[model samples]
Structure formats: C-alpha cells, structure tokens
Target: MRLTRPMLALTGAVAVLALSACGAGGDDEAKAPETATGSLEQLAAKAKCDPNMQTDADEIRQAICTTGKDKYILATFATDRGQAEWLSGAKDYGGYYLVGRKWVAVGQEKTVTALQGKLGGTMEEGSEHMNPGGSHNKGGHHS
Candidate 1:
C-alpha cells in the first residue's frame, strides 16, 4: 500500500488504544483465575459491610474502627460461595484480610497469616500498591 503519514499515525493511535483497553481495569479471571482477594470483595459487598471496604489498604470494608481484636477474614470460593469472619478480640485495632477457605488460624495473628502459609504467600506487608499483587500487608497500614 502507499505510505501516508496521517494514516500511519492514526493506525498507531488505534493500536495503542486497543492495547491500553486490554489492560484498562480489573484483573483477568481466566488466565490468573479468581484469587482469594476477589472473593473478599464479593462477600463484603454482599453483606453490605461498606462500600469503602474495598481498597488497596487493610482498613475495614469501610473506615470504621475495628477495635478489640475484631477482624474480618474474607474467604472467597471458586463456586461463588463467599465466606466472612467478623473476628473480635482485645484491641481497638483490627485489620482486614483477603484470604481463602484453606486458611487456618493458629494461636494468634489474623487468618491472613495462616492462609498465606497455606497459599505459599507471605502475608502482604505495607501498602497494597507496594506489593507485586497489590495486596494489603499484615501491619495494616492504611496510608
């Protein structure tokens, strides 16, 4: 075909847009499949826990203070059956964990640790954006 400057530019732009669109939003389910994190969001939303619950941080499903050892264990299943744990204990500070059913709670520590052990994952630490998978860390730093 004949070479045209405008045609080439437009073609390039279109290709870029298409490529960007592919990576636009949400992770791929088929390729990576649904991880435990995906299930947490689903269950929390269903329970009407809070809209703000879904975040890159370990804060509550919302900003509510999860005082007194209370925590939430969001367990997602491949069969669309989501589970939740409104765990409470003895601290005014609580955390949320995006975990799976396979996770087990030892003596102490959030189920995230137990689940992480089962999944061969390190209970994420620090900001969600800092990790490779964008998960919340154990310390639960909302900032």
Candidate 2:
C-alpha cells in the first residue's frame, strides 16, 4: 500500500487530538487532591468541636474549641497576609500550631497533633525560649 498525503494529514490530526486528550487527563491526575477550606464554625464542625466564639473581627474570626478536655484555639483569617503575620507574632510565644489554608489551630503539642488528624493541617512549633540557666522563661529573669 502506498502512503497518501490526505491519509497522513488525517493520521497526524488524530494523533494530535489523542495527545491533547492524554495531556489534559494527565494534568488532572498529577494535581494533588484539593483540601477543603472553610470558616471557623465549619472547620470546628468537621473537627467535632463546639466552637466558643472568641474574636469575630473583620481581619480574623477565632474560636476556642475543647475536644475531650484538650483545648485549642481555631482561627480563620480574612487574608493570607493577615494569617501569616499573626502566625509570625504568635510563634514567639512557644506553642504548637496546626496551620492550614488561611487558618490555624493553636494548642498543646498533643492537642494540636490530635486536631491535625481531624483538621488536615501542617504542624508548626514556636520557639521554646529556653534560658541558659535551664529555664523555659520569657524574659529569663530570676529575682
């Protein structure tokens, strides 16, 4: 059988379409599964907590949640920058933070770890602020 120009063009077009379709599907598969992001109440509900409203401000909405005697503060931010700034400042105090998309849950290490299992966030730790005299004090002052 002799090759023809029309048949070659059709074959090339079909190949292009098949490649394009494969590329599209590959992109979808390559991407990670989207994590759910929600408000303070919605997230607390997911984590099975009765959120006590702490601060309901324009920049952030915060709630104190107690899960089985483990207390934690869950906060959702209006802007990513605000959340980052808050986290930065809070880190100096030394605690465990379960961080998500524009949201953070502050608590003890064990509590935050447990929350992360339910909330799906990365664990962050603040500085322990230890003094040279084997003391975990803020200003390291012993009078």
Candidate 3:
C-alpha cells in the first residue's frame, strides 16, 4: 500500500510523542521541599529521607542546628568520574537532599541523579545513592 502524507506525519508525531514520554522525570510528589527550611525531622519525615545536617560550614551552621534549630541534613559526596567530589565546606541535608545540599546534590540536570543518591544522614559516608521513591531505573538513567 502507498503511504500518504498524513500517514507519514502521523508516524513522525508518534515517534516524537514516544520520545517525550520517555524523557519525563518524577512528579512533584517525589520532590522534597525546594529549600530545607523546615524542621529537620519534619522534612525528613515528609521526604522519607535520612537527614545528615553537617556542622562547621557557615550556611550549614546557620541552616541546621544539632542543638535544636532548623534541622537540615548535611551531606558530602564523592564522584566516580571525579566531577568534583560533591564537597562543600559544610552542607545541610544529603539523603534525598534539597538543592545544594551535598556532593551529588540534585539540580535541574541531576533531578533523577540526586533522587538516586542515598548518601548522608549519619556522620559516616555512603557507597552509592538510593531512590526513596522505590522506583528502579528499568528503562535507563534519568535524563
């Protein structure tokens, strides 16, 4: 059968739609607060993520408090490829960290990557990141 112009356009549209669907990321429910500006325990509970709350850095110092303050987790990350060891002199929140929390902190580009991170919480470091959403990377890495 001969393909018509409309058929060709329909095929192209389907291909684009398929690609866009595959590129989608987690929705708002999956995201922790944009800023770790609430009770550390509360945010952790809401996000269901472990809190680190590093001490010593100015921002972390002012942001989180071990002696009963904001309660943000502090995290430091080291990368496998050496794209900056995710170190901040001090950071607040690591496990499912808020933006700018630690080494593998999530941003627009690293949304899924940060969600994948499972480091931080206790004083000790972690081996790799974990997904709090309990979703797996079945298709591939997040865009």
Candidate 4:
C-alpha cells in the first residue's frame, strides 16, 4: 500500500480527537467523588488517640490522637458541604495528611501515615500554611 497526504491528515485528526475524548481533566476541573459520612465513633475507633479527646464544634468534629511521640488532629465535617469546604481549604496546607469524604488528619509525617494506614485514603505532603481564607497566620495568629 502507498501513503497519501489526505489520509495521513485524517488519521492525525482522528487520533487527536480520540485522545481528547479519553483524556481526564486537570485537577481544577476534576470533581471529587461523593463521600459518605462515617460515625464519629468509627473515626474514634480508627484513631490512636483517646476517643474522649474530641471536639464537637458546630462546624467541625475533631479527635486528638497521640501515636509514638507525635500528636495529631483528625477531623471530619458534619455535612457533605462542610467536607467539601474543608477539603478545598486544606488541600494546599501541606505536611503528611489524608483527606477522605468523611475524614481528614493533620500531623507529623509518621503520625499522619499511621492514621492514614488505619483509615484508608490518599496522603499528601507540602507546606503547612496554605489556608484558603487567609485567616490564620504562620505564627499561630488568627485574625
């Protein structure tokens, strides 16, 4: 068989279309999977810290756990909207952390890893002051 110019152009166009159709969007355009809420008790059970070390604030639910010599805060939102809000805000705050539909943990790398192992989620690392709202200062000041 002999090659022709039009055929090659058509083939290239088709290839590009096919690749675009099968492509995934960038992170900004990607939608996160809907996450179901787990009971606070379940979260506590998976945490290394005492179940009693928890906060039942209106906006957030959190548990404080200590593993080895590291203490970290494991948190979850009360509603799906809350979860989305927190995830969007926290995604940039680096360090060893895990974010799930119903849970998030922040702490030292090893401590976050141990809890993530028990809880099951993706772990990420980066800077620790990527607050979305610009409310918290690096020096622990909030305004």
Candidate 5:
C-alpha cells in the first residue's frame, strides 16, 4: 500500500480528533471544580448551613456553619498561596480538613466527611503534635 503525504496528515488529524472526543465524554465528572467559586455564605448554603460570619477580611473570609448537629468552619481565600499557607499552619492543630480549590472546611472527621458530600473536596488529616514533657500533675507529688 502506498501512502501519500496528504493522506498521512489526514490520518493524524483524525487520530487527534478521536482522542479529544474520548476525553470530552466524562470530563464533567472526571475533573474536580478548579475553584469553589463562591463566597463563604454561598458555600455554606450549598452545604445546607447558615454561616455565622467569623472573619471577613480582604484576603480571606471565614464563617462557622452548623449542618444538623455538626459544626464546621468554612473558609475561602483570595489567593491559592494564602489558602495553602493557612492550611499548613492549621494542620499543626490536628483535625479533619476538607480541601477544595481556594477553600477548606475544618471540623471533626465525621463532620468534614459529611460536608464533602455536598461540597466536593479532598479529605486531609492533620498530624497531632505531641507534648514533650510528661503530664504535670496539678495535685502535686504524693509523699
């Protein structure tokens, strides 16, 4: 079989188109939202909670939300770097974190997990910092 240059180009184009079509099919579900895309209140609404505004600043906005009996902190950052920095510092406290782009929800493991159902995010577990010294007994040393 003899293949001409034009025939080769056409074949390459067809292959590219086929691959693109395959990728497009499940893109909606396959790709997570690039960003949470809402204010603290809006996000809280999505999780079925009315946020009690805790901190409203230019760089970040935070609020306390209670869905059912579970209470969680919902925070959104103006910049990705700010969110990452905040997460890094907060993780030292050791708790459950639901992280989405430019936003995070912090609370108990169950609470965070439940929030994940309504808000799409990845779960992160913070490491607990241990006390260096033994427990200080306020009762004083026994004789």
Candidate 6:
C-alpha cells in the first residue's frame, strides 16, 4: 500500500468528518433537553434563580443564581462525562446538582433541588458540601 501524503490527508479529513457526525459520542436519550421549551433566562425564571450567565473553558453555559443568602450554578454539557466532571469539581465548592444534560445547579441543596423540580431533572447527591437531596417546597424565592 502506497501511503502518499495526499492519501494521508484525505484519510484524516474523512476521519474528522466521521467523528463530527457521531456528535459528542453519547446516547440521544441521555442528551435530552431538561426543559420543555424556553431560553436559559426563561428557565431561570421558572426555576426562581437569578441568571448570571457564563461559559466555562469547555463552553458549558453556566447560569449562576442567588436568593440573597443561598447561591447556585446551572449549566448544560454535551455529555454525561462532561457533566460528571463538572459535578466532581463543583461538588468540592458547595451544592451541585445535575438536571439531565441540559442543566446543572450548584448552591444550597434546597435551592438546587427547587431548581431541579422546576427544570425537570434528577438530583446528584453524595457530596460533603451538599445536604441530602430532596425538593424543598419553601425558600429559594428569586427576586
């Protein structure tokens, strides 16, 4: 087999295209949107969290919010692993929760849980900085 430069370049291009088509290498079910329909701002409103939008180096959209005393962060990642990595790092600081692939919340457990309910996702507990996971019917009213 003659491995010419042109052939190598062609191969590389094809490989790149194939990888791009795969789209983050995850199940479609896992990547479902956390909300029914709305912008991040709308979701924040529904969740009763102030939206301080920011993106991390990985391009994850972080929406930080606070209810005077309590604060939290929400973001969406492309893959479960990405979300896990974010949660792992974020758990150290304080309350962090994953609301599917489309949302993450970090702050007081009650606040995060409230957001989780509003956003429609699961709560990932087991961090020292976070209290036990459960939806709080009180507090977390965002102004």
lDDT of each: 0.29, 0.62, 0.30, 0.51, 0.61, 0.48
TM-score of each: 0.19, 0.66, 0.22, 0.53, 0.65, 0.50
TM-score of model 4 relative to the true fold? 0.53
lDDT at position 122, candidate 4: 66
Give lDDT tens digits, candidate 3, residues 13-120. Answer: 332223222232444333333443333345344445555553233222211212122222222222222212232211111222233333223222133233333222
lDDT string, candidate 4, 1-143, tens digits: 33233432233233222322232211222233333237666765655456444456665666655444455666766666766555554444434456777676665554555555566666665433533223234467554
Misplaced by over 4 Å in model 6 are 1-39, 56-58, 67-70, 92-98, 129-143
Off by over 4 Å in 3: 1-36, 56-143
The per-residue C-alpha lDDT of model 1 at residue 54 equals 20
lDDT of 2: 0.62
Error of model 5, residue 12, in angstroms? 53
Q: How would you encode candidate 5's per-residue C-alpha lDDT over 41-82 as one tens digit per residue? A: 778888788788866767777776766566667888888987
Count of steric clashes across candidates, in order? 9, 0, 14, 3, 0, 1
Q: Report model 6's TM-score to 2 decimal places.
A: 0.50
lDDT of 1 by residue, 95-126 (tens): 22333443211112333333333233223232
- Taking all chains together, the TM-score of candidate 3 against the true structure is 0.22
As for TM-score, the candidate ahead, 2 or 4, is 2
Q: How does candidate 6 score on lDDT?
A: 0.48
- Highest TM-score: give the candidate number: 2
Ranking by lDDT: 2, 5, 4, 6, 3, 1
Candidate 6 or 2, higher lDDT: 2
Quick one: RMSD of model 6? Answer: 16.8
